[model samples]
Target: MADKPSTPLLDTVNSPAELRALPREDLRQLADELRSEMIDAVSVTGGHLGAGLGVVELTVALHTVFDTPHDRIIWDVGHQAYPHKILTGRRDRMRTLRQKDGLSGFTRRAESEYDPFGAGHSSTSISAGLGMAVASDHLGTPRNVIAVIGDGAMSAGMAYEAMNNAGAMDARLIVVLNDNDMSIAPPTGALRTYLAKLVSGPVYRGTREAAKAVVQKLPPFLHEPARKTEEFARSFFTGGTLFEELGFYYVGPLDGHNLDDLLPILENVRDAGAGPILVHVVTKKGKGYAPAENSADKYHGVSKFNVITGAQAKAPSNAPSYTSVFAETLIQEARDDERIVAVTAAMPSGTGLDKFAELFPNRIYDVGIAEQHAVTFAAGMATEGMKPFCAIYSTFLQRAYDQVVHDVAIQGLPVRFAIDRAGYVGADGPTHAGNYDNAYLGAIPGIVQMAAADEAELRHMVATAAAYDAGPIAFRYPRGDGMGVDMPERGAILPIGKGRIVRQGGTIALLSYGTRLGEVLAAADRLAALGLNPTVADARFLKPLDEELIARLAATHDVVISTEEGGLGGFGSHVATFLAANGLLDGKTRFRPLMIPDRFVEHASQADMYAEAGLDRTGIVNTALTTLGYDQAAMTAALAKI
Candidate 1:
């Protein structure tokens, strides 16, 4: 018992440098302790578990080799940066990971000198590292810039664009392709097969370097011809022929876990003085832990869990989440309509398409992390008279904004966008928060946007998207459970560009959209207590908004308050625009647009997140009272009556 209480490995590690101070035999022990510490920290404060676990050895080796603060190392998506953060000075604060006013889940530039560029979304590392390398060259500071990107992120076009540009400029950048064979889920596309070949093959690495050296040693006049021959040889060997064409001297298919292999190769690449070299390191997701290794995706981003059992600590939810609801709804529709098909960008389970994929494997398209391709592909599917439902997270959809505007909206394709996580995502932090979808998406022409108040409404929205044969339609829902509303056994399509008046009132009208409708109802209850009968209207369709309802509400009610959980240019802003344009918001009529303040919302619990944004019940009541100039005494008395 006395011996169990004290662990030498735990005592020895204070930082990465200290870990590096240990012997080769002791370093493996240190890694074990580090992984244990990570598991312990994350079990208390839930976050990305499998990714960090998978990259433990790579993290250790990289820190052991590179001088971090001097040599820029950027982690793509930053979910796996927890280990990096712990290795770097933030170990003690591991318990505060993703908590409010604590350490961010992703790499933050402001957090420490070690973090070069902040990232949350995937596939931005290579481009950022290239910029750093170019800047380093220009400033006469030749520091090594490294981008460690996962295979899932490799699917995004931005990575290719970055690789293309970096290869063209011949920037001194080292891209570590951490192919764990999983990125959120198993990566998709032709590149995945190419990666599989590279990771599995043995001969690609040994002969390529010798061949490249022979080419370099040739005469200056024969260099171009020799280079082309070497290029053809690389194409034949690695089959990243495209990468060779882009100008990168591709290396690896190296064993990421084995420090013996990784360290030497990294040193060789560092010494070789190559231009924008890609070091493909193959790794297994959830390498050390049996439970995580067995089910990597399930453990990918876990809630607070029991260390012993690997069971989530949180109680099982009574109500189904919006994602599960969407999945079931899509399946029901697909069963009836042969044309209905579902598509996701490497998120079959996260987007709730796993069951759908299982049901109709051929109909489902898991397009890796390529959101742009997913949208355009769906548009192409729609053009051929197939009902394509492009289910994507709101934050990821930001990546495909150009595609949404150009392919789906402009072409008037009937591609259904099931935008999930359209509000404050708690622990994943601001980078993963889906706050701006409505505002940006609403600006697109020939596009219809709808927000569901609950699960039943989401089902209805799905039906609406399916039934509508004209143009693109987007329906957004929040992350968590529904309002316990009874779901329809079968979905029925609702009218396009129309709203439903949930509660009827007299002088004051509350126009709400999306999940904020719940808050509006709460405020309406308070108003009712004040003997102020407020009309509650759900503005279902954002574009081609219920103008008749707005006009009537403006004329009938003494004041009209528009509410939404999105930033300016969202539902509330659009309502304000409509009212102002129609001369409805005059000195006579009081109109207040209650929207999320124009700013970035940091990580916090959903309730705290909403309260901070002033989108809660109390905030709504305060806004109502302020607009009406009601005193505290009057408001309190009114509250008592309710």
Candidate 2:
């Protein structure tokens, strides 16, 4: 954008300390500059733009009012923390967001002291902040702990759970309710600002405490009613009845974009006597930038884009995404069966269920950020003979693990889980990586887990999950476009728990579980170049291990390698377990499972991550060669020739 917009005020401040030192009147100018810098940086790097843009003034106000590093500030989900990052001495690293060995898109504890708690998944700020506040109290170091949470995140029960705990313990915690999505309280003018400041100030707090003291002396029956009357009178005007009920001193419905409104209210909040305070700050999503302000959802998570035109830069893809295939295929099945319903945890578009919702408007349920609720809701639907497909990101589905085990799996409900973004997610990194589905779902007894090899496989898996009305079934597919294979008009329901041989060849067998099938085939080609045509097979189901296929490959092939996209305890782990139990690893046969390493791989391109994990073609070929008794030097030499 204009070769990086000039940010004189932003450049002058290296950290929040400098930001605080500036004249109070100049803070608005500083915020403007900060917003510009964030906009430019995100436009280049591509990240959570709208959220960050929305919280520009709030970030500035929080940093200015609170003595951060000493005072803790936790941003829920960390989507809006980019501006916070810039103000907190990470201004220089803004360009490196979500890149390999670069700054994380989400707040990371490892990144800086400014980031006290890391958050990638939604609705964890209050819990983490409360824990920090409790720790601080126990240590006798009472510092202000402010948790900035979005309205979307508040839908999750964990936020309330933390608040309930905080209220019970009377922990000094400040929860800044950044209400940008839902219109909880739209009024943000002078009157609202005045009331917010007045209520949060010492005078109002002291008066309230005195009133409570007078009420406490009354009859026990009258005391409860007196307290309720006081709260009811205030909440009638202020609109925080729910928060007040949860034992939080509620303030605001203030204009978050207005520094004048935010600054004084935050200062009052910081200085006020608080057991647990909820400051409701209402702001517009994508506040400053016109493009984002117009279409906030589109800019929520963007690619590199033009500052003037707001057009994102996307690489041309020949095939549809696996998420789209799942949606389209599900739609195809739903057309035939009216009982089909879809569910998503605040990610209808991300899971491609928005397409399904277009045709079956009443059937698709957007359950906000509550993953646990989404799972159980799907389970409830399934109990009624409705084919409920619960679509959620793999990492997010981890949040509903208990529900998966206790509700779906335990009840033996026929709930279909369409797990999207399974495997190494490119920019979002390990936090968003769908690496545990194969492990987690596989562990649940009677739960059938399948990983798609490509788009066609994803389509078939969707059909398969729809057709199979047994127990809980989950199908995982990686992020990004599929391999450009021939499209099937309508996916045929595949045989459950069956493995298929793709290429028949020599004594070296390369068995793949998921999208790694492409890499395995390429590795087979590489092996063919090395005069070793390996037998390539796709093990479709992770849970129902194909004993017959394993026996055939073990009996025939000298070297058998199992490749999967996820970490250990996945398809590879299952295959290894099957082979071990069957005594297939006894004599001359060597079985090696290639999956993600024990540790988390940082953010990178999918190809880079796969290659790093030894799940790429080169890695697969090397594994085959190494296990065949070839030394590192020999394998290196052989690969170089290929």
Candidate 3:
């Protein structure tokens, strides 16, 4: 455990009410203490560090200025909500963050009254806040609704959509644009560039105060013209005129770290009677910590670390991560294929495209936090005869499903979908889990869906996707390091809809997909010890499943167990459907599909989550033994031994 930081002011406040009671001048000290406490807690827990550090003062100011539980404050992306959580009643559970049965890494509505909206993925806060604002007005309980959205989140179309609607409706909503100039990666798109110009412009620095004073002093008729002139001049020099055109009353590129500036502005906005307003505040990603500020990514997400040195404590792994393998293999493939290009929705490093960008900078595109745009953009690229790989997290791909179905699948475009984090991602919890990708993508016709059994297989899958130019193809892989397999120098594209048998057996067969191959093999070894050798085969492609191999396995084996690291309606469901249609299961061939249960698995270690879902080696062994009519006592004893 990391040494606990002394937080005398923070210790006094257990809830937002206490924070609200504190003197305005004392808030600076409270903010410092709160930041220190958050750092210390996160040092032990290992979650989002930089975002929370950046918003310490902002979080403090918002809580102090507003009646939180009643006045809805929705945090966009929620990675920056750790300080908010601390300032609320969850300070005691700070050390238990992201753990099983603990506080979520992202803001969860069920967890707290203060978190009015749940969020994991970005760019929904404005919409949620608008809904709350409208609801409050309808209920006749006039409460302020503030949406704190990052500049990176503004890159998404949803933010603009909400903004346009809110502006049109003329609802009393406050949008605090937290412009840190960085998301998970340095933000992409024109908005970031515009914000950069706005921050650097002389008009923003010099005339903002003068313009505000002039507008205040002018008559009612002159106020509109004067404000318009100021807006036009600022737009000429900076670029906030677009926001004003959207009908939001735009105010300041204020220093977000300065509580003196943030508090007064927030109080004014809270008290003001007007339509939708946007307060643009500039903040550093890692404001207080020198080491975090000095780091390239501003130490955004971190593992448990040494607080004194700011060195994260990541466990050493000899194996390369699945993400790294994908990046390297894609790079190798791109070297040979000149038409091959990559696209990511603001996750260059998260998707391992940073490495790809380093080698082929021109070939890779970092589209901001816009998954829908990323998909359609890739489809457009594919239409132009370019091999476009739309690399996205499995969970995030859910956001672009309409595009995947309409643009890619309908058009039969050869857009390669490289899906990372294809299973239960630990710590991030159910919201970020890549559980539904297989099921969702499998439901779409004319799309080849594949899952890798191991790192080496991932290489082959990457090559397969790259080579596959017939239609849209997707390959899913898990979150962490590979199973220390010897990687090939170059990947060979495998035959479509093909699978390979690792071990041939008699009584039973284990058909595995994705990373569960290791567990299946382990279970097979355990079954071998019990004098029951089960056949193990890796079903590489889920869509065009190896029907021939599946038929033979079902016919020959007494029991067929299909296993995958995805939800119920995924690879296992597909296999079951194929077998049922073929009349393969009418005979003595008893079938069992092992997958993640219907319920959302909570935050836990990957191993623990798998065990809970009955997908681990022990679980597999137990399932196999029970399916083969082993007695309860015998099964329990066997499982205990395993």
Candidate 4:
């Protein structure tokens, strides 16, 4: 681990109150110190480094000007809240970030009072801040509410919805637009272009300030007309006329890195009167770090690294990641299938569509942080006879559920849903976990849902989705690397709604879904050693429910354990419901469905989380033994042997 950087100025400030006590001139030094400390802390505990680096000055300015814990300050997505966390007295625990029982990578309401609202997703801060502002109004309190949102997050329709609502209400709300021109990937759509134009236009800074000043000095009756005149002229100069029309008192495209520039603007906005106000502050992602600044992604998310060299530490992987496999397979399939096209909601790289874009740039589309738009756009393409694959993360797909139901499922459009990160994603925690997709998507009638047991299986499922044209079809794969299985030349589209048996046994059967097949097979091997060989099968399709295989297992075996890396109402629940409804549970068959517990799992290593949920190898063995009526002592002894 790298040694902690010296932060002499930062040492004195343990809290935001302490920071607020400092003189304005000394704030520059404090901001520099904060950036260094953030870099050092993230060097030890890798996380969202570039975003935090970008927000150092803005965070200091906000904390210094506003009263936190009392005055609400919400960070959209919360990836940029590391500096906020340090200033809010979490510096001591900074090194333990994103670990088991440690500081969360994103903001958590339970973690600190300063983090008024928890966030791990984007475009929520403004709505939440507006709600707080209205609540304070109702309570007759004079507290200020500020929401800091990035430009990339602005692409989502929800941000505009909140802005429209806040504008209409004329609420006393402050929204600081952190236009860093980046959000994981380079931003897309007209919003990014408008922001860029706003920052680059020479008339934006001086002309807008002069207009505000001139309008303030005019007579009370003429002030409204003069302000309107200035807004029309400013719209010709800068592109913020849209914001003005949205009912916000639009402020500048100021320098976010300069405390001198940021402090006064934030202070003025903090002291401003009624009506929703927007202060646009321009920033550079990975501002202070040279390596990150030079990189295309600006090291948006990073691992522990050397401070001087900026070389991040990465664990060596023996196999390709599930994401890469999907990308490669999709690319290969697209070569032969001219009708195939790809769509992603501003996550081209994360969903591996970046690689697809390289091969078939015309076929791939980035819909810009609008999941609903991405799904519907794919549905539209499907209507035109194009096989559109909507590649999205499982967690992010939740935002477009209505579109998935109404646009695709209801119409029975053959839009291929490539759900990446379908299970518990490590570091990112519950907010980004693809835990609920199985349950949610399975409930929709006529939609085919499949979960890959490994990397090779994922390739086949992708092919399967591409080949199937009946209705909406989705295939889910977990985050991280493949199981090092031998690769085939190309994927073979498997029989839809059918499962294949991997191993044969007699007394008990383990029906696995998604990536849990490895652990199930491991448990099967252990049971075989103990003279209790169990049948092992991978139920690839969750929605179609592999009824024949499931019935055969239940009838032949004394016990059947259904396992999946999903929530309570997911694959396991579906299997259990099917078994009970089909009278498969009426005989001597004792069925146990192993799944994620009905509670939100915290940030931990994936292995530890599965163990905690009792879904690990030992956990599965224990469940089988206990279900077979083994005594507590025998169960413990059997587990100990494994």
The best candidate in terms of lDDT? 2
Model 2: per-residue lDDT, tens digit, 498-609? Answer: 9899999977999889988888888899899989989999989887888899889999989999988888888878888888898988978999999899898889888888
Score each candidate by Cα lDDT: 0.83, 0.89, 0.88, 0.88
Report the lDDT tens digits of candidate 3 across residue range 59-174: 99899889978888889879999999998899999889999889999999899999999989899999999998998888899999999999489999999999999999999999
Across residues 50-124, which tens digit of lDDT does each residue of candidate 1 receive?
A: 888878888888887787779888999798788798888888788898888888889999999889999999999
In terms of lDDT, the poorest run of 10 residues in model 1 is 1-10
Candidate RMSDs in Å, in order, are 4.5, 1.1, 4.9, 4.5
User: What TM-score, over all chains together, does every model reach?
Assistant: 0.91, 0.99, 0.93, 0.93
Clashing pairs in 1: none
- Compute the lDDT for candidate 1: 0.83
Reference-based lDDT, residue 207, model 4: 64
Candidate 4 local lDDT, 1-642, one digit each (tens):
556677888999999999989989999998888888888888887998888888989999999989987999999979999999999999999989999889999999999999999999899999999999999999999899999999489999999999999999999999988989732223344454454445333445446677779878878899888877877765554457878899987666666787766675676666556778887777888988898788737388898899999999988989899999999999999999999999999888888889999889899999888999999999999999999999999999999999999999999999999999887888889899889999899889999999999999998998898899999999999988999998887889988889999999899999999899999999999999888999999999987888999999999999999899899788888878888999999999999999988888899888888888878888998899999999998877876775
**Cα deviation in Å at residue 576, candidate 3?**
0.8
